[model samples]
Target: MACSLCIGTVLPILRRMRRLAVLLLLVLPHGASRGLEREAFEVYHQRRRAVSEAHPDGLILLLGYERQEAQAVRSPFRQENNFYYLTGWNEPGAALLLIPAQGDGSVYQELLFLPPDDPSHEKWHGPRAAPDDADIRSQTGFESVLPISKLATRLSRAAKKRSHVYTLFPHRAGEGKQPEPDRREKLQTHAGELPIADIRAQLEAMRAVKSEGEIRLIRKAVDASIAAHIEAWQEIEAGLYEYQILGPMLAAMINGGCLRPAYAPIIGSGPNSTALHYTAGRRRLEPGEVVVMDVGGEYAHYAADLTRTVPVDGVFTERQREIYDLVLYVQRKVIAAVKPGETLRGLTHKAKRYFDEAGRDAAGEAMGASFLHGVGHSVGLGVHDPIDFSQPLKAGMVITIEPGLYLPEEDLGVRIEDMVLVTENGAQLLSKGLPKEADEIEKLMRGR
Candidate 1:
């Protein structure tokens, strides 16, 4: 009788232990919740470490915006670049708070504030992660996750001792809007005499240089862009409308996993070619005219920019070849001078000098007059990513080298652009596979 009683109790205990083990296995920590890999979250950790090191006594606050689904049609939500840089969290209306260590036996603290999931609303939309989710902390690598409603009260209590708080105030054009007004007021109300400092400068400086992972994402964007340009070369004909060619090219980019265009694809034929930034690709191509196609693709939030000009009928006329070759020559020279220790202004000066000495119009006006814009700009999360143009080029910096000449009188324009990566020794042409030479473009167009 004693043996049978002991067996019954032992069996129940063993079953409960098995259930607990399975539960623990189901909740193993994930690197990120979305499609992001572990490396991305590691990048976030590195950024947080850097911020904490710089501001040992302060707290960093960054607010994320919820998608305005009510105001517009539903679409995929994109997190602000700066916020995404620090945390791989992709949801909307979230807030992040970080407290740095002062080495007084204090520990660094990172917290994420999240909105609750409403089942009634989720029936119309979809369910979202809540503060109590174990993945919320695991995926974001945040120390703790709490309700967003607790932000003001919690921050106010922490800052009551006159602690410094750093945030991204004084928004720039491309930067997202500031934190919610009520929350901003509440933080200030509790801050008393403590002043809020802007951290934009520090963040921009950190983003200017490409890390290994960032370079990989950028290369994916550039490769997709190159494929799109090649498709455009194959499809351009003397009788097709500009949009007709653009349609297939864009399809190719999207099919290749680039869901967004870096910017509007600029397909300008004939007179439209003379108008920079002409995006209305409604013109029909005619034989003996040049078409300038400037388009790129964005992959994983990184961008690629490229421009190529070609003859509409697969052949360049004598005058067309003259202008094309001249522009190509100067473009190559500028690209060759893209090593470190060079500033954008210095490169622009060199381009101007080269154009002045090499070519002239009928009345002897300098070809440099037709050069309308700066030599190039940095490319990254934004097509025209923010940068200090006066700062010397650094290794891992990616930029575009484009030189052009537009002659409205003759109804002619020629531009050649390529993406380049500044390396330790010099530069590497990321878009080298695309044909830019007049002969090569013509040969490719002829299906040779």
Candidate 2:
């Protein structure tokens, strides 16, 4: 009678627990239930192998951002770019160590160090993967997963055997407050005499060339950004605040599944448009004024950069059309020149020459003088993704062709920007879906 009573009571409780588990699984995000949303394990695995091959005798160490405590006001956490590039692990307070193959027949090894699970922390922040979790290896693509407490010991051991420690060093002086400075200081104590090689250049080169998966993500970002721009065009008109136009664009980006803007969106109207990097969207647009809308969306950490200057009244005035046409002409000329073996500096020079020869500003000066910024920049993980400006363009590389003429005297600024992919033979415009022609833009705004 006692056994029967115990079994009867426990069966109902077990069924209840099972039902709760099922309900939670249905409610949680796919990435949360598994791990952070990321590419396949092999993509990261291949990248690690390539890095190991590059530095066969040295140890590569990458430190991720430390986890921040929950606060009333705190920015969302983003993983360190280089670390995320190598390992797809997005969780904070993780570290990656790559041990090169040894001559003594030891194989190349990669290890991921994760913070120990704190039940108290999880109570507030939700559950995080512990090193001992069953699926940690498959999730992180690192066969050897260990507690972060083991990081120093592992690095010390590896440093003693390795000839050099390869990691990102500060690129310049007075950058003491940057993320790299603190991480490098800590690495020095652990690395001791092992000469530290600045691996930043190599990583930048690797990141310049997008993998197939990265391009897909970038295309998604571009698509979302284009949709957002269209929304803005439909809603823009005279007497509306600059931010009022920005509202619809942001909504479109979010609805299209973008995580955030590539950078702060810039919506400058009238005189404000003449200021480069203008983000303040407070001005009330007036008739016959041009508003420069420089915006893009970031999807899955990849970024898209685009800019369009349109008339507030849905029609460009005579002077606006003239400057706009010159800017568009120069942009097309520069983009047409994009191909293998062409340097960004070269393309920039070409753009300036085109601007100078094509037209003059209201002040009778060369129009190129009005072009304040570089013609283009590498775009990927960063809106202005880092690359050696002198390096020649290669296939699979994505860059922007943006040419703008800012004439503060005329209170006019016109910029045409698009993302381009360097192809085997020529260039392919990734953001071609967005219309740049004045007629097309007017039609779009007029809903004709």
lDDT by candidate, in order shown: 0.77, 0.83
Taking the tens digit of each residue's C-alpha lDDT, what string does model 2 give over 262-371?
A: 88899999999998888878899999999999999887778899999999989999989988988898898898899999989999899999999987766789878888
After superposition, which runs of candidate 1 have C-alpha atoms over 4 Å from their true positions? Answer: 1-39, 69-75, 170-193
Clashing pairs in 1: none
Model 1 Cα lDDT, one tens digit per residue, 129-231: 8898768767567768899988877677666443688876544554212332224554465455678777778987888788888788788778877877887
List candidate 2 segments past 4 Å from native: 1-37, 68-74, 171-181
Instruction: TM-score for candidate 2, please give it.
Output: 0.88
What TM-score do all the candidates reach, one by one? 0.84, 0.88
Residue 48's lDDT in candidate 1? 78
RMSD of each: 16.2, 12.6
What are the clashing pairs of model 2? none
